[model samples]
Target: MIKFFRNIRQRLLTENKFSKYLIYAIGEIVLVVFGILIALQINTWNDERKAQKVEDNFFYDVLLDLKKDNANLNYYKKFHTKRITYLDTLLTYVRNPNKTMGIKKFGMYTEPLFYTVAPTSYETTFESAKSMGEFNNFKEKQLVKDLSQYYADFVQLENSFSSITRFVENQFEPLMYKLPEGYMSEDTGMLVINEEDVQEFYNKVASIKDNRKITYDYEIILKTPNTENYLIGDMGRSYTALGKIITRQEVLTKLERALNKTIKR
Candidate 1:
């Protein structure tokens, strides 16, 4: 194609038709410029396609992370709900002067209270994307806003758990320890052992046959300074954690929907 154009130009120059040559020269320049523009447009299209692919992959990984987060939130919600129920039971037993309870049964209820399930979040994908500035590539402004808010909620959720943990360590656990020996036992079905360690745990518990030595005295426990207060604190903290989890789930759902729309595009 270049040789053909060159020959035509050479013939026109030889014919000495200066006006026609000028017109032909302008036409060639216009053709070259048009071709360059088309090439540039194609290159731009390719770059955009590649960027879109990267964005798609990033969002897909984000979706997977969100799914994991949702599962974790569900688990925490259920766990906190059950904890609140146990705390309620303990509170009721302590509040009612007419009610009586045995230490063994009380131990079963109180054992689980000693443990705290801290909130867990899957933010690896988000952190990676942020560190690399992938978020800037996102075209949907609303999606970016939702994502920022969604991850921010994780911080609040963690703070809630920290409060619960501090209460357990500083007040609740110490007070419970002051109780009579065997008031709370390790074999009270509170420990969650892995499947592989289940048999070993059972063997250890079985070896300690005479574990229950103290009997529950409702009046004594009720009279113990701040026992009811600690129980109430525990319930309140658990309730707070539950509320955070619920809110997080809603935000997650919104983010997931935004991601679905962006990924489809």
Candidate 2:
């Protein structure tokens, strides 16, 4: 192609009649410039196609992640709500005078830990974060950079939410488990419990509750003359874990918005 153009240029210059040759020369130059522009446009199109492919893969991953996060958030929410109902009933058991009638202590409804601790369900968004790398070679590298930073910020917020939830969930073990013995009877390895012994167990219950308090040493729940520390497990507001899962749901909503805009589009 180069040789053909060169030959045309040389032939035109050798002609004495310059008018016809000048027009031909101008036309050839125009064709060459047009050809170069077309090649550049094709290159740009190819790059865009590659970038779109990367974005498509990334969006699919983010969609799956959001769905998982949403499902997990819901599961934790349900877990927390049921726990609250049980906790409220236990509170009633604590305050009622009928507890002395040998009514079993509020152990049955709260005794799951005797058999097994309720397994915590976990949801992860890190897969979406990792998948954004599909766009690493994209012409618009900023797409990946921006998405990665967004995910980082989101995950940090998620961690904070988890910390709050841990605080709440941490309080639950003490309530469900009677002692190191859990909800089981120490003498018989049975779950049957009596509240007559439970009033006597006030200090023991407080001891268990106290251990879960933030101020284990300050001695707040220790009733008069019974100075035994009631503290047992990590302290937190009862619904704190459930609340964290709820907050994560909010984060998932935000993540979905981001992914749809950045990836799906």
Candidate 3:
């Protein structure tokens, strides 16, 4: 093509058609400029396509993480609800001294409150996307906003959970150990007291004929009422926070499906 254009220019110059040669030269320059522009446009499209793939991968990982988070939150919901029930029963006995005998049947409802059952949120992928500005690949501003808000809320909830955990281990567990021979189970969080041990604690309480001993022994048996109150309040807050996280996880699940569908199309 270059040789053909060169021949034409030389022939035109030899024939002294200067005006025609000038027009041909301008036309050739225009074609070269147009070709360069088309090449650049194609390169830009290719780059965009690659970025879109990266965005899709990020969303896929995020969807998986959300699913895991939903499951974890559900498990926590059930676990904390069980703990609340145990706490409620024990508190009721504390409120009514007559019900304290029933506490023997309840087997000293001492759960391993110190055991942390924190939810697992796989947020590394999301954080990586944010730090690298991969979110820009997504066209929908609302999606980005929703993701940002969810992660921000997660941080707050996680911190609250950690604080509550520390409080339980440091303050509440020691108070629990002072109660009786029964102790908390390592695995199931249920208190484990031999029948003999239970009877012994009951016998000691029953034999306390002196009014002063009765009051002191009962107080000793339920030594952690204040600790329980703090735990109940904190655990309630934790439950509420977990519920919110579950709700957001469900919403994000839907969003993930929608985006995946749209991308596939």
User: Evaluated with TM-score, which candidate comes out highest?
Assistant: 1
Model 2 root-mean-square deviation = 10.5
User: How does model 2 fare in lDDT?
Assistant: 0.49
Q: Which has the better lDDT: candidate 2, or candidate 3?
A: 3
Q: By TM-score, how accurate is candidate 3? A: 0.70
lDDT of each: 0.78, 0.49, 0.64
Per-model TM-score, in order, reads 0.89, 0.57, 0.70
Task: Give me the overall lDDT of model 3.
Answer: 0.64
Ranking by TM-score: 1, 3, 2
lDDT of 2 by residue, 91-202 (tens): 4444453543121343344442222113222223344445555445554465445545545545544454455345445544543332343322322212323212443343
- Pitting candidate 1 against candidate 3, the one with the higher TM-score is 1
Off by over 4 Å in 1: 180-187, 190-203, 211-219
Deviating ranges (above 4 Å) for candidate 2: 1-15, 100-105, 113-236, 261-265
